[model samples]
Target chain A: MDRAIAIDVSHLSKSYGSHVAVADISFQVYAGEIFGLLGPNGAGKSTTLRTLITLLTPSSGTATVLGLDTVRDADKVRHVIGYVPQERAIDRFLTGREHLELLAALYHLPKDEAAKRIGELLKLVELESHADRPAKTYSGGMKRKLDIACGLLPDPKILFLDEPTLGLDVQSRLRIWDYVRMLKARGMTVVMTTNYLDEADQLCDRLAIIDGGRIKTLGSPVELKVGLGGDIVSVTLKESAKIPALESALKGQPAIRAVRATDKGLDIRVESPEKALPAVLEAANRLNCGVEFIQYNRPRLDDVFIAHTGRRIEETTPSKME
Target chain B: MKEYWQEISALTMRWVRRLSREKFSMLFTLVQPMLFWLIFFGNLFQRAADTQVTQAPNYISFLAAGVVVMTVLNNGLAGGVDLLFDKENGFLERLMSTPIHRTSVILSRFIFVMAITSLQVLVILGVAFLFGVRPATGLLGIAAILLIGMMFGVGLTAISMAMAFSVKSHGDFFSVLGFLSLPMIFLSSALVPLAAMPGWMSFLAKFNPMTWAIDAVRPLILSGWSEALPHVGMVIVVMVIFDALCLYGGAKAFRRAMG
Candidate 1:
């Protein structure tokens, strides 16, 4: 049996004046699945999430959460959805427990229920020990946990987490990952946007790689990698000048799909690295280019991104792109 | 309807809880208007009663009503500062993304401002009473004073919230607020009677909502219900119209900002 759809967005487009932020993006998130939107800064990931959460209205097209129109039935959609914004939506003056209780009330939970849920959420986030402390005194990770706890107070059917672990330490990020897994086990549908490629690869059951306000690719991590249909072979040559001879020697081989030079090595894409390595070694010997290092590995999400965009995901981001 | 009230009360409690933690700002908001009444205006007009420059028995009693309105004005106008910070810090967006009614957000802000302003007005009245002033209308008059102050406050709070949504930053919000508040205070009957002002200033004061509020409230402190009732009714009418227009504008701006 097919799973129920938790979120459905179709031909959604958002624009600011003449600049389109989300351009005709379409996707569906299934119930009880962790769906990720992987993109660089200014790639419209947050904009799409914001529109679905009803914080923003789309310029054109329609989005629905659990069959409630995001624009027409915005209030109803909000009622059933929890949103953790990219920015820390925390009040420094309030304690962690106070924040949760306030959100519980805002969600219209009963007083007794709110209290019980707050207690459970604090424990779930492992913030029970410091729940009474002012949020201003909490570290970045602690604050993020508080934010996620606040979002979970409504027991929402769908949760939208925008960069849930952005700017966190490794330990804090791992903790958040665990919480997300736990949430999925409890049958909650989660839609998250992240810049961390590995995090998306590991946590998201399926993801859409968005860039330039468009969905470039969409599939499970393994499926996306397999779709690239090539293995990556990196060869470090003793001199950069020898790259030209190596390329010429391997250019006519059918197994060798593509070749590109990097700062330290030549990155070759091929149908089979096992079959392609012998030809590469022979070419290196004939060209008098010493091979300092060589390795073959399966395509990663980064490789999939590079294959689709012709540039690394990191290179397309705001800081690196500039 | 019950759910609306529940959401409003919940959101209002958030503001109240934050306000309670901010001891210094709470103290300042309550005490600043009283200082103006007791120290600045009170001493300056010390001999006005002797000269019959004022209609009341003393300047403190006449100024007491104005002080109450001023307190409401200050609180109402500054009410959006918290909202501006909320918008800046993303808290407002968080609240907006929830299942609560959107109007409840703005309504709760008005409620929180009115509640705090009512307390400040009481403290100002309590201080004026210590200075030998008694409202001729007594307890009923105190109720009228609060009603007038709140009516005026609702209009001002609506305008402030509108500005908070329209402006881009807190600095711009504050500058606009400062530009409006001082002129509004001087142009109204807050500091002195309209009769004492120049002809043009008096004419302008007639059009000022703040003037209408002070006019309505001043009689409650100095005279009885028979004299104060008409102005009180007029102030309420003005406030209703003013709040309707301002709230409509604020809601429009808020919607645009959310978009």
Candidate 2:
């Protein structure tokens, strides 16, 4: 229970009889930071979130939010944490203003206070003009904005967003990210889960790369990219079968730290991928392998997923049960 | 408790706003019971020269109380289904993560159904008054109707939510709810007098909480508060027990769903 840690999950696990939804995952989200749980669907992200929000009791281990046990002090935890679920929470039958007003009431805001908060949230989400329209008439993005507005109705200490931008258009997704950043700027701790690597890289101050119900790695975007130990040289091959030839040809190079074949191409880990590229290209040309594409960039979270799990992120299908 | 009341009032108003927003849906909920009371009861009473022996005096009066009870039950039970759909659609989980009390969730739903059904009940009562069925209980009867209806509505809402929580899909929820509503309605002396039923049916009706409710309302509707006090006591006790059971069951279901 460190003062700076808003959410402290210690080996938290949740199982249903035989199926383990989240298995012994541990992480800490510091106060006033945007912490992302990056994982595929059913990869224990939602279960971890549910546990933190006190929606489910952990099968083993413990989690505390704002110095309160997520289980024992659930009511208190609930009071401080605002959860924006993956699905839209807007009651289509309710108008936008009415929706916000109802949520404001749920937070025990007095009539005048609730009205003020509703007005503020509606304006913040830019739905004030459509405040009186039924939510059913709202576009997907507007509904999403309203949903996020509802989450912020209580001005919580910490916010848990479960796939906040899962199905939204790019504009809506960025808009949500903007609000999440604003929340951070206002000293609110934010915990979000997403499978999108770009989102995690762009929005998260610190991120946990989760897969198969466990923490694969945890670091800031730059820290993780740096921790990958070197640059990433991705060479897209014209033929899938040419990967072995390319790997063998580059294996003896001292600059090539690691080599692996991906569906898209062969990835070479080196101290400096740009400096190593000429050698790699020479090897590929000597091996009679055609290179369709090549690039040198800092390691991606997906590369980290691959580096640790020995599997690509895109191919890692989430289990059906979770 | 202050927080609870605040949340409840807020949720209650939310439903009121929704009702206003979705006037067509409100009209549907409002018209079905009225139609049941007006057309079917009106037609039955029109041919009631011989049927007066079964209906006391006016047939519409007998049917009005029954329709009110039925409307409350249907709306409350189905409100749970809507809750389940909201869960499936992810609204409930989102709401729960807010600082709102868990009880407020149930209260809001109960308030919604009660508001909808109360409006419908008033419509039927108004039409009943027009049909020459005025009770001497006057304001007392209206209070009793609102009280009993609200209790029963909340109780049924709890049961429906419990079923919705226990079941995985709306279809299953509806199936179980439909199965329960019919027996509960039939066992109660809603449509027929308990004395006229067969021996076993009469015995079942005597134990049915619905029977107690209808009996309680019958006195208020027919001759004000002249009835014995035991029936009122029985109705209150049954309502208490049913509401407690439903609330307990519903809370358990909610816990499981959240998990």
Candidate 3:
């Protein structure tokens, strides 16, 4: 897809004294695409997002939003971008509509125009009936919806969501996901950070897998999964001792690329699961090890992370995405 | 520039709306100083608040200016509290991410707290009327009293906002507030004349900005403009310097915190 660059972050690093929250990293987000920073907690997702939105200055390197430098033209950048923080940012004392009105006023929206926008945003978030109720009374999902509505008051060109569905119930999560897709459909570039593997895979157009304050890899979900290594046939042997023997026997067979013995069983990587399944079972039988269980599917994003980091990021976080 | 004012007014009105919703807090804020300090405590010491000692027609008249200044001090010192709560709850981050003028946040708070303090001053002056006391200088005298209170408030509010930016937690902010407010009120001429105090306490009162504010406002209520003029001039100069220093400190802390 040919799209103009909405955000360009080059060699960015943010540190606080001895602790580095975001090490040197660089990536670009194309306009109208949903770009995600996918990582477990404390992986510098928030710091990078903060810098891009001009909330925090980078320690080194530079970033531009719509070709405006983030630090030097922070004010100009703010006018064009919307940010929904990781934490719930609603004022409990203010009603949902009041929150939108306050933001509109901050943005200097004209009274007549602001009124119309507030009404439309309230409806957009499905808070029309509860718009006048104080946010303290809102449920977790409702509060979050109002928060999103407030962010959209400026009708920004790009929206940054730091963990958009974090702590949301399943139904709320789906609703937020739909809202994000709607934003993209309207040609608004969406940038988000998430620790949920499923969220990155399902929601993002492209994702940068971050770990230890650095981007381990960056690509589309499909490209990342395919690049990890194609179809995998997992063979579990009843006798754990014979797993390594079975692994060596399966290596270099037809369609078999590599074999690794895991605690539970043996995972055989292949060009295709259909072709590799026969070789895997045949090898297990020749080793005289009972093939207790076998399963195969297309490689997942987690395997891509495992390929790069030598560890599972899913183990460090929680989610259906995990 | 127009957007700056819009931002400030909207945020200030937010404070007003929040106060309106909290019925209990609204009532207490308006009536607390009047009931506990002005009416009860002022009368409890009526006999001892002599004309010679207080330099006023009566005890209530003397305490009126004192209470007005005291209210300004309390309101201004606690001015940063809402911002601190906003910071704790992550609203400050959301606000900073927007294009609104950053100074609007601090200035709106000063405006709201000073406005509330002026309202409290008016209420105290009206209550003093019930105690058979009137400002010897009249309506202009009431205006001067508010002016001095505001000048004093600008400085105190700046310091509080600075503290809010620097502190690690809300608990810590309140702790510092208590540590600073009580001693300042007692050490100044809020409850009694500095001359009526011990030698050491009176010496510290000489240095308290609250003492300068109260002394200036006292003449407005007790005597005429000629007598009040000098004190007002001294306090204004003091407030200018105090506000400058506090604003500088607040700006520095804000830059560090925001960065």
Give the per-residue Cα lDDT of candidate 1 at A121.
92
Q: How do the residues A34-153 of candidate 2 rate in per-residue lDDT, one tens digit apiece?
A: 999887776788888888988888999999998899888888888887878775667888888887777777777778988888888889999999999888999989988888888888
Clashing pairs in 3: A198-A321
**Chain B TM-score (each prediction, in order):** 0.94, 0.88, 0.96
Query: Per-residue alpha-carbon lDDT of model 3 for A1-322, expressed as tens digits?
Result: 5779999999999999999989999999999999999887778888899899998899999999999999999999999999887656889899998888888888889999999999999899999999999999999999889878877889999999988888889999999999999999999999999988899999999999998889999999999988877877888878899977887777778789888889979887888877877777777777788978888878888788788777877534443211
Question: Model 3 chain A, poorest ten-residue lDDT window?
Answer: A313-322
lDDT of 2 by residue, B52-80 (tens): 44455766667667777777777877877
Calculate model 2's interface RMSD in Å.
Answer: 1.6
Alpha-carbon local distance difference test for all models: 0.86, 0.80, 0.88
Against the native complex, each candidate's DockQ, computed on alpha carbons, is 0.73, 0.65, 0.82
True contacts kept of each: 0.81, 0.88, 0.86
- DockQ of structure 1: 0.73
**Model 3 CA deviation exceeding 4 Å by range:** A306-322, B48-52
Q: Which candidate wins on DockQ?
A: 3
**Model 2 regions lying over 4 Å from their true place:** A1-3, A109-120, A222-252, A259-268, A278-299, A307-322, B45-55, B115-119, B136-138, B186-188, B198-207, B223-230
Which is superior by DockQ, 1 or 3? 3
- The order of the candidates by TM-score, greatest first, is 3, 1, 2
lDDT of 2: 0.80
Instruction: Indicate the fraction of true inter-chain contacts that candidate 1 also forms.
Output: 0.81
